[model samples]
Every structure is written in C-alpha cells, then in structure tokens.
Target: MSGTALLLVLAAAVCHASWNVVAHGVSRIGTPFLWWGAVASAVLWLPVVPFTGGLGGSVGGLALGAGVSAVLHVVYMVVLQRGYAAGSLSTVYATARGTGPAVSAVLAVLLLGERLSALAAIGIAVVVAGVVATGLVDRRPRQAPAPVDGAAAIADGAAAPASTGGASEEPAPRADAAPRRRRRLDPGIAWGLLTGLAIASYTIWDAHALRTWELSPVSFMVGVTAVEVLFYTATLGRRRRELLDVVRAHWPRVLAFGVLSPMSYILVLVAIQTTPVALVAPARETSVVMVAVFGALVLREGSVAKRLTASVVVLGGIALLAL
Candidate 1:
C-alpha cells in the first residue's frame, strides 16, 4: 500500500473513534443529539457535493438511496445511543465494530452466495469470540469491599444512637457506596449486537446504491445526510426545546460528531481510490482497538488490560478476513 493511502486510513480510524467517543459522552440527550447531528452534518457537507461529483448523473436514484440510507442510519444512531447509555464505551464500541463486518460477511454469503475460504471462516469464529470477550470484560467479579473505618466510626460518637430510641446512628450511606452488583446483567453486549446489525443494514444498502448509481462519495454522503436531517426533523419537530437545550449544553460534542463522523467515511472513500480495499477495510477496524483503549483508559469504565487484549484479538480476525 502507498504510504499516503495508509496514512489516510489510519487518520480515518482516529476520526471514527473520536466521533464515537463524542457520541457516548452526550448520548444521554437522545433524540435531541441525533437531530442536531443530522442537521449539522448535512449543512457541513452540503457545500462539498458539487466539487466531489454532483448526483453521479442520477437525481432519482440519489433520492431513493439517500432516503433508504437515512432510515438505516437513524436506526443505527438510535440504537447506538441506547447502547452507550446501557453499557461501557469499551464493550459497546468494541462489540459493534467487531460485529458489523461479521454480519456483512454473513449477509454476503447468504444473499449473494459468496463463498468464504477456510481462513475467512476462522476469522468469523475469532471475531465472535473476541466480541464476547469484550462484552464480558466489564462483568468482572466484584472486588471485596474495603474494611470499614472502625476508629473513625467509634470516634464519631456512635453513642448518638442512644438518643434516637436506640436506632443505629450509622450514616445514611451514600447512594453509590454499595458494593457492585448485577455485573452479569449489563445489557451492553446485547445493545452492541443490535447496533452492529443496524450498521450492516446501512452498509449493504449504501454499497449497492452507490455502486449501482455510480454516485460519488461526496454526493452520496451529502444526499444521505440531507435526508437524515429531514427524517430527524419530521420525527423530532415537537422537540425544539430539548434539541436547543442539548445544543446549548453540548455544542462542542455536537459539532465534533458532525465533522468527525463524515470525515472518517470520506477519508476512507478517498483512500480507496488509491489503496486496495483489502488494506483500507482492515485499517478501519483499527478504530476498534483505539476506542476500546480509550474506554479502558480515558473513560476508566472497564479493566484496561482485558479490553485491550480483546480488542487486539478482534483486529486479528479483521486482518484475517481482509486476507
């Protein structure tokens, strides 16, 4: 691969992970965030449509493709937000990234009758195992609670209980002071799998639409992002106050997602013109590792070593699939 193309792919991976981090940070606002994202992305990218390739010679197909893609992407965004709310960043991002290509490969085989070599089959298995590993990484056994401060408790005059009808004067415990529970019940993995399914749906339809209509990457992205705005507006028209509040509170994250999300895709598309897709595709999965590491280190939500180890395994499978 050319050095420039490789660099572009790596850059795209960073953008992808960066935007995902942005998404997780503000996902609590839900539809408000999605609405702002659609609007900002469309406005940000609209100007580039003409320069990249206007319509790719098919206005009708562009509408159809963008409409369908909009639906798919909205589903993706909704599910992704829910996943972020439900689980740690590491588990959700790692599992979704790993699962997307696995779902795509399965679809290609089942619908297009594409055959996988032995290596590809093994890659699928490895990906599945790695996804599970990431998902379960946060479900670690709870550490034993710290020993209570007997000296401080005694010095604080626990004898006050005698004044309260002999009721124990133990402090009303802070809400989060309890030992961890329900680690096995975290729904992050399930939500991640759902998000991955949404990713595959959009990826398949978008690929077919772009190739069939010969749409330029820029035009197609602009069209789809525009459609997304319309969809978000139609669905969220009554949420003006909520939307405005999110923008007021988190405009930095909103704009970051707006820029980073599309930039990631556009960079890969541009790189694909010069690099073999086999290389570009696997390079994109590098974000799987970056985000996992981000979650473990920056977010401090899971075991760093466990998430990093699982992310590496996922990337290994991706490399094999690329082969």
Candidate 2:
C-alpha cells in the first residue's frame, strides 16, 4: 500500500470500529435500524457529493456502479443476517471475516491484475489469522443462539448488520427458538462462506467501480445508500411501525452508523484508487483489533490476554505490509 493509501485504510478502520462500538445493540432492532441508517446516510451525504466531485463521471456510469454496489451490499447484509440465524455467532462471524480478505486478496491479484510482494502476502495471511482469532473469542461451551435475518428479526425482534462492511451483534435467538433455526447438518459454515463471498464480491466490485469508472466515492456511496433505502423499504412489508419506533428511539445511533459506515467504505474506496486491493483488503481488517480494544476497555469484557495477543499479531502483520 502507498503511504497515503495506508493512512486512509487505517482511518477507515477507526471509523468502522467506532460505529460498531456505538451500535452496540442494533442487532436487536434489525432492519429498522439499517433502514434508518441507509436513509440517514443518503440524506446526510447527498449535499457533500457535489462538493467532493459530483458524479465525477457519466451519470450512466455512476448509476451502474452505485446500483450494482447497493445490490451487493444488501445481499451481504441478508446473507450475514442469515448466517447469524443459521449457526453459532462465532462460527459465522469468524469464518466469514477469515474467508473474506483471503478471497478478496486472491481476486485482486487474479482479476484486478494487482501483485503483492512475498512479505505483503504473508502480512495479509497473518492479518486474516488474527482477525479470525479475535472473532473466535465469543465462543462459549453452551453456544450462543444464531442471529436472526433482517425480515425474520423484525418479527422475532432481532437484526444484525455486516462488519468491515458494517456489524453482527444481533441478539442471540430466543433460547427456545434456537434449535429450529440452526441446521444440524450444516451449522453456519455454509452461510458463513456465502457471506464471505458476498463481502469479497462487493469489496472487489466497489474497488472496480472507483478505479475503472472514476466515480466520486461520496456520490457513489450516496447513490448506494439511496438504493439501499429503497430496497429496505420495499422489503419492510408491515414493519413500518417498527421503523418509526426505531427512528424515534434510536436516531442517535442511526445517525452515527449512517455517517461512519459510509465514511469507512468511502475511505477504503479512495485507498483502492492508489493502492492494490490485495493490500487494502487485509489492511482493513485492522478494525478487528480496534474492536477488541473497545471490548476490553469500554465494554469491560474479559479475554484481555487473548485480545492483546491478537492485537500484537495484527500489528506485526501491518508492520510487514509497511516493510
């Protein structure tokens, strides 16, 4: 990564971690929160789009890039929510994040014609390892319930967002309902893989959009947020009341997520303009360590030694990338 690219991705990481920290209980609220967040993002950032670069390309190109990215991002949320509902949280979260950067790195090299140095490649691998280790920290002997999908979560009173891309803290399924939602044969690995692919797909495609189409990051993201708001609204069905309740009760968090989530991704898009996606992909995983720090310091969670070890490993990997 170029030094500028590195700084941007790290800033993106901090933004990503900050919102995830702020959105602690969003999973319990489900689609309503994401809906509000999307609405807020579009409305909040629309004005800045013109100042940043306006379409920065043809309207057709901007629509294509933003439209496609919106679909992929929504798919990511749906699949990730299902993964939460399909298996253990730790299983889904760890597997998806672990798989995402690896797949993104490989595709960046093979499809995007980006090359990574041997040491940088190793750095990417180490970062993925540390991220998975951090994700794995939530596992318990009794097993937490799988998370609920957005639509289902509306009915069940739970919902989760994507990480890197957004969050996965949907409340565990009700104890009595957990068994039926979980698959005895598959666990969460299947859904996790699907989620991982979705993550990589959007990551690569969004990079392609910014790099190939030359769309302004702000405009593209604003378009994406607008499309997502529509998609979420169409799927809301009879849940309009839920949306209103969330808006009224949690507008602050909705606002925080709206601003930070897109900020995180917009920064990543900018980084990808100057840096190879292979490096930016794994480098973004640094957010996982920041989240661990949040858990230790803010949330007063346990696993201090383990989180510290993971942080050290992730930092070491980052050092390798800088080499």
Candidate 3:
C-alpha cells in the first residue's frame, strides 16, 4: 500500500469505531436509529452524487452492482442494530467484524480461486479462533451468590408460609426463570454470524462492482448512500413513530453517524483506488480492536481484559492477512 493509502485506512479505522460507539450508546432505538443515520448520510453526500456521476454514470452494468450493494447495506444495518441490542458492543462488534475477513478469505479461495501464503493461512486461523473465543465463550465472570446456611434456610422456610402465603418466594423462582430462558438463546453469537455473512456478501459484490464499472469511489459511495437511505425509509412499516422518536431524542448521533459512516468508507474507497482490495480490507478491520476498547472503556461493557486479549489476537491475524 502507498503511504497515503495507509494513512487513509488508519483514519477510517478510528472513524469507524467512533460512530459505532455512538450507535451502541443508543442502540435501544433499533432500526429507527439506523434509518435516521442513513438519512443524514444521504443528505450530506447528496451534493457529491451530482458531481461524481449522479448515481448513474456510463450506465450499463453499474446499476445492478450498485443496487445489490444498497440492498446488502440495508441488511448490514439491521444486523448491526440488532447485535447491539442483544450483546455487549465489544463482543458483538469484535465477533461480527472478525467474522467478515475470515469468511471473505474463504470465499476468495473457493469462488475467486485466490491463493494465500502460509502466513496468511495462519492469520486466518488465528482470526477464527479469536472470534470463537470472544463471541461464543461466555467469559464474563459470574458472581456466585453467597451460600445460605442450613439453619438459616430452615428458619427462613419456617417463617415464609405465615407471611403472604410465600408470595415473595414464589416470585424469586419466576424471576429466575426468565434469565434461564434468555441464556438458552444467545442472540449475540447468532447476530454476529449474520452480520459477518452480510459483510462478506457486500464485500464480494463491491469487488465485482468496482471491477465492472471502474467508477470513481466518490460517485459510487454517494449513489449507494442515497439508495440505503431510501431502502431504510421505505422499510419503516408501522415504525414511523419510533423513527421520529429516535430523531427527536438523538439528533446528534443522527448527525454523527450520518457523517462518519459514509465518510469512513469513502476513505477506504479512496485507498482501494491506490492499493489492492485485499490489502485495504484487512487493514480497515483494524477498527475491531478499537471498537473493543471503546466498548470496554466508554461503554463500560464487562470482561474488558479478556475481550482486549481476544481483540489483539484478531488484529494480529488481520495484520498478517494484510501483509
């Protein structure tokens, strides 16, 4: 990679993590939050669309690629929002981001018939291992409830029936039941996997689109951002109130994510013009580590040390892939 491309990728990494932090902070709004962000992004980049080909320059095959990319991005946004809802930002983000490159690598080998060096293979393994460790294994330290003495248990049992017919004791078991049910379905891992798949799909489509159209990065991004905004807006489906609520409550985030999301990728697109996509993709994922740290420190997600360790391993693998 050229020095300028290297710097652009690094900047993109930081900006990517920063907006994700913004989104994670208000993930409760779900798809609405995402939609607003896309709206903002579309507005901001709209001017560039006219200058950079107005969503259809030298049209023939570019339309399909751009359309597919827009559809993929909508799915990516939904999965990311849901992932934030179901899991900690660090684990979900790390797992989702980490899964992308590994899957992308496999696709390259199987579909594109790309060859990797031994070092890149090892790197892919490390990335997969780290993702499993971070995403699947519940490493959060559980606080064991203090053990009750036999005498106290008997005393409590004896006293319970006289008061409200053991109502308090009944609710304890019922309350405990919900958490057990929740534990059975770990949405974090599931959503992470889905997010990874979406990333891989878009990566492949974008690669093909670039090769076919050879359009400038600015034009392509502007068109895609506009389409993403339209897609998300159309899918509101009885959720318009919820979307309005997000806009009212978190306009700053709407603006921040709006600018950051598209601009960050614009940087990557520029880098791709100068460097190979193989180099740019892995280099951009360095944000995975940054997102983990942001989750632990700014968001106060648990198991910071363990998550960071896993993030380091994943980043090592990504760096190897880039090399």
Candidate 4:
C-alpha cells in the first residue's frame, strides 16, 4: 500500500468504528440503523443529483449493484442487531468486521482474478489467525461469585465469628453458584457471514463497474444511495414506525453515521482502485481492532484483558499486511 492509500484506509477504519459505536449506543438498534441508512442516502443523493448527467448512462449497472447491496444491507442489519444483543460487543464486532475483508480477499482472487503477492498472502493469513484467536478468547467462560462479603455480619454491624462448618455444610455453596455466563454465539453469526459475502460481492462488483463506466465518485455514491433507499423502503415497510422514531430521536447522530459510512466505503473503493485488493481488504479490517477498543473504553463492556489482546493481535496483522 502507498502512503496515501494507507492513510485513507486508516481514516475509513476510524469512521467505521465511530458509526458502529453510534449504532450500538442508541436505545434501539433497528430503528437507528434504518434512520442511518435513510439519512446517508439523502446526504449523498440530494446535493449531487443535478450534476449526475454522466451517471444517467451507467444507471442500469449502478442500480443493479445497489439492489444487491440493499439486500446485503438488510442482512447486515439483522446480523448486527443479533450479534450485539447476544454476544459480547468486542467478540461479535471483531468477528463480523474481520471476516468481511478476509472473505473479500479470497473472493477477489477467485472471482475478480486478482493476485496477491506471497507476502500479502502471508499477511492475510496472520490477520485471519489473529481474528480467530480473538474470537476464541472472547468466548471463554468467566467466574463471578455472588456478593457474600456484605452478608457475613449481623444486624449489630459487627463482624460475625467464624464457624468450623464442614465444606459440604457451608450453605451448600449456594445451589445457584455458577460461573459467569458465556454469551451464546448469535445465530446471526451465520447471517453475518452472509452479510460479509454480500459486502464483498458488491464492493468488487462496484469497483469493476466504476472502472468500466468511468463514473465519478460523488455520482456513483448518489446513485447507489438512491437505489438503496428505494429498496429499503420497499422491503422494510413493516418497520417504518420503528425506523422513523429512531430517526426523530437521534437524527444528528444518525446523519453523522450515515455520512461517514459511505465516505468510508468510498475511500476503500478508491484505495482498491489504486492499491492491491489484498492490501486494501486487510487494511480495512483494521476497524475490528478499533471496535474492540471502543467496546472496552467507550462502551464500557467487560473482558478488558481479552479485548486489549485482540486489538493488539489485529494491529499486528495489519502491520504484516503492509509488508
């Protein structure tokens, strides 16, 4: 990766983390996601609709790509919601984010006929291994005992004398005494895999389309966003009220999220146009580490040690990719 491409990928990583934090921090995930999509579509489409004269010629392919993307987005929303609801924020976010680029790299080779240098392939393997390790560690069981120290005294606020009770007679160790619950993998992880495939498909396809049609970046985003709005409204009409409520309550954050997301995608797309797809995809996965950090410090979730380690591993993988 060139210096400029690397910088752009880094910027995209920041944007990806920011939007995810906004999505998860909201009171309702589904509604915020919908609103984010709508606002993003409007932001991209409204300003440049008039200047898209050249885009008119490429409308068919752009629309087709957008249609595929919209479907993928629906799947993404579903998986993202379930992933956040059922698993640790760091674990699910790391898996989903890391998996997409990995899939993209593989698909780029097979479908797009892109070649990765031997070094780049090694880098991709290291990154994938790191992501897998993070997931494994995040899923391990934890032990958390109930608050027993507070109840060891009498009503007189004095310490109770110790009793030589047998080990089995020690209140039977509380029948409910069990290790802290390990979150179950969301069935959405499967959905997340599908979502990642969708993302990779459209990204590679769109990049090819852009090259063939020579569409300007602004116009391409506008067209894709317009089509996405139509598709989302058509398919998710049942959830309109929920979607609207989220938009009304968190309009500013939603708008910001929307704007940043497409901008991030645009940056990655541009980077791929110039750099190797293998390089760009792995570099983009750097967002996984960012999300893990956000989960620890910003979201204030538990498992700090695991998350920190995962973040380091992810960064290490990114470094390897740069080589």
Among all candidates shown, the one with the greatest TM-score: 2
Query: Total clashing residue pairs per candidate?
Result: 0, 3, 0, 0
Each model's lDDT: 0.64, 0.78, 0.63, 0.59
Report the C-alpha lDDT of model 2 over 115-157, residue by residue, as the tens digit: 8899999999999888888877755532445345464221101
Off by over 4 Å in 3: 1-4, 49-57, 77-95, 110-113, 131-191, 242-245, 273-278
Model 2 lDDT, full chain set: 0.78
Candidate 4 residue-wise lDDT, 1-323, digit = tens: 67888898989878776666555544334333554565575675567656644454477766665556555555555545444444433344446655767888888888778888787787787776666565555453322212222112111001111122223323434445533222444443554465456556666766666666665555666656665566556655566667667667777776765676676776776677677676787777666566656666766754778778876776776777666
Model 3 scores a TM of: 0.72
TM-score for each model:
0.71, 0.87, 0.72, 0.73
Pick out the ten consecutive residues of candidate 1 with the lowest summed lDDT.
Answer: 154-163
What lDDT tens digits, residue by residue, belong to model 1 across residues 113-188? Answer: 4566787678666756676576567753322222221111100001000001223467866767554543355566
Best by lDDT: 2
Q: After superposition, how far is residue 217 of candidate 4 from its true place, in Å?
A: 3.1
Cα error, candidate 2, residue 302 (Å): 3.5
Candidate 2 — which residues are off by over 4 angstroms?
142-147, 151-186
- Per-residue lDDT of 1 in model 2: 65
